[model samples]
Target: MKRAWSPGAVYVEFSSDPRDWPSVGVALLVLVGMGAALVLSFLVFDERRFGCMSGIEIGKTLVQVALRQLAQLASKNDEQLHREREELALQWSAELKAAVPQAVAYLESRVDDLDARIAELSSDPQLRRVYTNFNFEAHREAIDERRRMLAHAAAGLINPEITVERKARVERTLRALDPADILMLHGANLVPGRMRGESLLGTPSGGDDNPGRMRADLLLGTPSGDVLASSGCVRMQVSGGGAGQGVWTEVFITQLGLDVLTALRTYTQNRKLSFVVPGREYKETDRTEEAARKILAALPGLGDLVSWSTRRSSQVERLYDRPRPTRGFAVLRFRMCQWQDWKLRLENLIPIYDKAEVNLVVSAEVQARSRDAKREVFVAQFNGPHDLLRYPADDCEALWT
Candidate 1:
């Protein structure tokens, strides 16, 4: 079926809807024209629109380039900073190394100065004396402590139940000990042997005659007028008596003897064993007859009595006329009268007897001039028989005159 086409009406065609095709062709043509116009418009406005966007793109590119350059610059600056830090650290280390030897030298110099000062102090005499005193005090203290320990041990060994062999051993130990070690054992003060007159006898005497025996007389103070206790051996006797009448004390002077004597003396002094008499007890007795003979014998008028005959002549002299006296009885009477007058004169010139006494004194002093000096001083007095003196007789003339 075909339909006719009208301007405003519907038309039908039989050739497969030919009327619809013309309308379709017109719509296509209209669409084709619109597409051509759209293409043309795009071609014209594209350049102008893109030109506006070109500036924004270029700006973005420039910004990216700047950012890259800044990053490179920042990397270089970090490297420079690291290098400077390393250099500074090295400079500080070098300075510290350079100062080390100088600092060491300065410390060494200070130490040397201190050493010199110590040496100087050591050489000073006063300081040396002080050190010596300190050492002596320390040594003394140690000795005292040792003495105490030894005493305690000795006390333990002194038990009654102990064996005789052990007792002997302990006794031997004590005997072998030094004197100074046991000085304070008995709690008795003792004087040093050096301080005593132990060295007064220069050489030791020899022979069986004991010199220390004479010291006993000095120690005991036995009254015997003619006895002389001297260091050397010189025989002397009393004028009127035999050798037996004079009490002689022999001494053998030796170092060991002297030391023993000193110890004895110290012991005796501490014990107060010497005999003492009151001053009033000492009296002068009349012995003019006996003293006269001695005075007459010592007179210058008597020549040296070297021989027995000379000594006899000095005692008695005879006055005889060249011509034998006609009367022997008259000569005898004259001699008797002369003898009596001489005896009276001799008695007036001499003292017959003497009174002797012993004196003792003890003193102590501290030297004011010394610095840190010991304040204690020990002194003792021991007098002998020779120290006695005769009382002057009222009738007698002075011997010197």
Candidate 2:
């Protein structure tokens, strides 16, 4: 096949912007007649498909092939763009779709920060304080003196004068002993228990507790064992000081105190640790005849309403078997009015005076009928040491009797 240039004129006028300052946009423009050789150069022969020719058929086919390639390129570009969009959607919603850990990485990072903060706070030594509010520095003098006296007393119990065999036996006993062996403050050293089954408070039966008793229930039961052994209270406290220090309270720790005393009695058999208490009776007492006078004086007067029947025994004494506080408290019958400086005072005291000397107990009653007067009063009581923060005699009769 032979191809010829059709009757068509090709025209072009190159233009330039004045801003570019090009004096000429088209360097050359010419119109020339195509010779037969230029036409033949592109001549397409049907017999030869791969030959280089500038024929109209070849040029048309070339243009058609380029257009097809352009269409394919456009399709490929569209496919690539679609893939890119899908990949972006996957990156954003992977957590919502597949539940991958990376999806929650941002939230997990914040959670990790909180856990680290908690761990740091728990590990800080300042936060693990076992004892607080002793005013250790303020009363160092008195405390030091008391500590010295206790050291002396302890030394006397394990005196050097004792034979070596006896000392060894005592040491062995001490090693095996626990809190229960103590008669008073017996197992005061409430350190953690060791791997060996022997408890720090050391008694095997340390956790047994009784429930019928109210005061007996406030004790703490830890893994190591029980402390503050409960004993039925003997005396009632009158009043106490400080906030939450109310009177009309009961102190339940006879069992614990007795345990501590028992341990002491065992340790210091030969040497006795006897100290004068205000009202408690111990095994050792001076049998002076003057004591008889004191006892008689302390006795109730004849037909006196105050001294009618002092004999008292607890009914549910057995509930204090395991020795723990009620994990609770009771309200006092008598309370101080807002006008009083000592807002709440204990109407009763359990004068331990030795072990857990005095506790700030409080009790409250919405309506307490005055014994001496025909009036209902709101009453609260606390337990602790109290001084003159006194009420007038007439007021006591009228308000609390």
Best by TM-score: 1
lDDT of 2 by residue, 298-349 (tens): 4222112112111111110000011114332211123322313222222121
- Candidate 2's TM-score: 0.15
lDDT of 1 by residue, 308-329 (tens): 1112222322221111133211
- Count the clashes in each prediction: 14, 66
User: Which segments of candidate 2 are over 4 A away from where they belong?
Assistant: 1-47, 50-54, 95-401
Q: List the global CA lDDT of all models.
A: 0.32, 0.30
lDDT of 1 at 89: 44
